[model samples]
Target: MPKFAANLSLMYNEYEFLDRFAAAARDGFTAVEFLFPYGFIAGEIKARLRDSELTQVLFNCPPGDWAAGERGIASLPGREEEFKRSIERALGYAQVLGNTRLHVMAGLLQYGQDRGRHLEVYLHNLAYAAQQAAAHGVTVLIEPINTRDMPGYLLNTQEEAHAICREVGAPNLKVQFDLYHCQIVEGDVAMTMRRDIAGIGHMQIAGVPERNEPDTGELHYPYLFGLMDELGYDGWVGCEYRPKAGTSEGLGWFRKVMSNKY
Candidate 1:
């Protein structure tokens, strides 16, 4: 069976942020990841992880001014300086938390922006991020978020993500294959995985259409997981999904498919 990491930011919404570490550990998840850990100090987050004996497999780089509706600044023009600073800051957290991968979100395109110029900035930023992450023994990931949940998102398909990874030509740069996004943007999840699993660094799962638990999704995760097993994928799969009930109560399918992720 594949290793799984609970997405504290999404799954344990009922608990306080600090409490979610223990909550996830109590629920039998030894590995966990989240959207961002910028609000808390590195020592504080590291201490929580140590106390719970949890391994944080992944987290995203700081997306500038999340409150002001800026999802990320990596691809935005005139934001390269901020993105570089965020990369350094993220590397510090990863070193402290023992996180191996960090996702660099490509900010959405605004009205009147040039697509060609945007891609240039994005690839440039990604190449830089990948270099920095590699120095810290961390791999940088780029995810293709679906247009439905996040319209105008710069990268929104697995094929495009795979191609970008190739274009960047960085050994440390890889794709974050989010099944929920892939199912919506592209239907052939299993086939996509088979084609470019080598370029994939991390994975996430959520239900289709509603973004709920995987059990209700149209995609047969069992079959996809079987394919992953066949391909010898040993990476931690982030459980980035909303619960229909209490987080623990809605973990029936997760627990059933889980194995010794140690």
Candidate 2:
């Protein structure tokens, strides 16, 4: 089975932000990821991870004005400087945390007419982020979020993500394939995942539609986990789902998957 990491931002919410690291550790999760860590300094987060002996697998670049509803600034035209700064700040944090993977969120698309401009900006910003991250031996990731969940999210398909990665042509640039979002937007999750596995840097999973525990969903996560093992996926598979019950209670799925081959 693939290595599993709890999403501290979405999982174990009962604990405070800084406390989630230890909570995940107590639940037998050796790796963890979150959206952003701006609230706490890198040194503080590093201490938490060190104390828990948990690996910080992945985290995202800062999204612009998160409190003001900005998902990202990457795809927003005329924000080149802001996007580059985000990448720099992310690298600094990743270095302190000893984490190499960073997800770069594509900004929201305002209207159909402005999409072309946004794509141009997105590609340019992605290329720069990839270049800078590569210098530090860090990999930059981009994910395709489902429009249903994030209506205006700029990136929405594997094809688009793959194409952008190609155009960027940076060895460090790769896709952050989130199974929940992919299943929501495109149903050929199995084939798409396998076909794009090489270019996929990191992967996340959650139950479809409800985005809850993987044990009860339209997807047969067992099959997917088996497929990942068959494919020799050595990267971390992040558990980025909401707990329909308590966080630890829903982890029966992970236990079941790890105990069996499928």
Candidate 3:
């Protein structure tokens, strides 16, 4: 079976942000990931993770203000300093929590920004960050968010993410292939996984359209999971979905789907 990790940021609606660690453990997840844990103190989160015995599989480097529509600035021009700062901050937190992977948000492309130039800058920054992460045994993942869900996003396709990874040519830098986003933008899940599995460092899931529990959505997760098994993927599949009802109620569906495999 694929190791499972709950995306506490999106999964739990029944508890406050800080309490989701316990909830994830209660739901039978041995590991968890979150968007950005910048608001809370790192020590506190790490302490809770220790208490809950939940490993930190992944967490995102802080993207700029979501309310301000700043999807991210990591790949944009004139934001190198800010992006580096974000990486350093993220590394600090990752160290505290014993995290092994960090998702580097590729910010939205600015108007009139030269794509080639931006890609160069992104490569340079990623190379530097990858070296830094290598020292600590943490890998960096670049996620390509679907433009349909996140308009104007810079990295929206697996091709683009793969190209960037190739250019960077670092062992520690890879792509975060979220199945939900990929399903929305491109429906060839199994084929894509087989093609890009080597470059992919992590994964996530949700039901398309509704972004709810896996079984509730149109995508056939069992088939996809089977494909993953055939491919011998050893990483965690993050359950990063919204709760249709309360978090606990939504969890029942997740449990049912997982039980079918047994």
Candidate 4:
């Protein structure tokens, strides 16, 4: 069976931000992930996780500025030093939370920048980040965001992501294979995962097109999850989707899926 985790950032809007853990726990989630927990103190968050008995499956390294339209800069040129600092900061939080995975968002590219040069910068930064994460027993994940949802995003395909991971050649560096984005950019989910599963360190899902609860969309998650089972994937599959009605209502679908045979 595939272990499911909830992305607290996207799931709960009913409670105050700091109270999300209690809400997620009430919803029956044993593990959770978030985009960026920069505002809260790491120690406080760790305490809450401990009290709640929730495992931190994954969390993102802080991307420079979201409001300024910057998704991440970990792979951008001229920002190597900034990117390293971001990784270190995330490591600090990960250590406290007992998190084993960190998602590296390969930010957006600046205008007039050569793609090749940017990729080279990303390669070097990733290698360095991987080394740092390895020392802390954390795996660094590189995600390929679909341009349709996030225009001008740096990485957008599993093929490119897989190639980058291979080039990086670090045990701690791997792809965060997000099923929703992959389904949007490229179908044939099972085959693609099978081909690149070796490089995958984490996984996430939302229904394609709508980005809502998995049961509300066209992707047959039963089969997709079945494929994951047959592949013997042992990583957490995060539910990173928007709730159609509410977090609790959306959770019913997850329960139904979990109860059924994949």
Which pairs in model 4 have colliding backbones?
A: 72-107
lDDT (10s digit) by residue, model 2, range 120-171: 9898898889888888999999999999988899999999999999998999
Task: For model 1, state the Cα shift of residue 114 in Å.
Answer: 0.3
Q: RMSD per prediction, one decimal?
A: 1.9, 1.1, 1.4, 1.2
Q: Which ten residues in a row have the lowest lDDT in candidate 3?
A: 253-262
Q: How does candidate 3 fare on TM-score?
A: 0.95
179: Cα error in model 3, Å: 0.7
Task: Give the TM-score comparing model 2 with the true structure, all chains together.
Answer: 0.97
Of models 3 and 4, which has the larger lDDT? 4
Deviation from native of the Cα of residue 136 in model 4, angstroms:
0.7
Off-target runs (Cα >4 Å) in candidate 3 are 257-262
Models ranked on TM-score = 2, 1, 4, 3
Model 2 stretches astray by more than 4 angstroms: none
Clashes of each: 0, 0, 1, 1
Estimate the TM-score for candidate 1.
0.97
- The weakest ten consecutive residues by lDDT in model 4 span 253-262
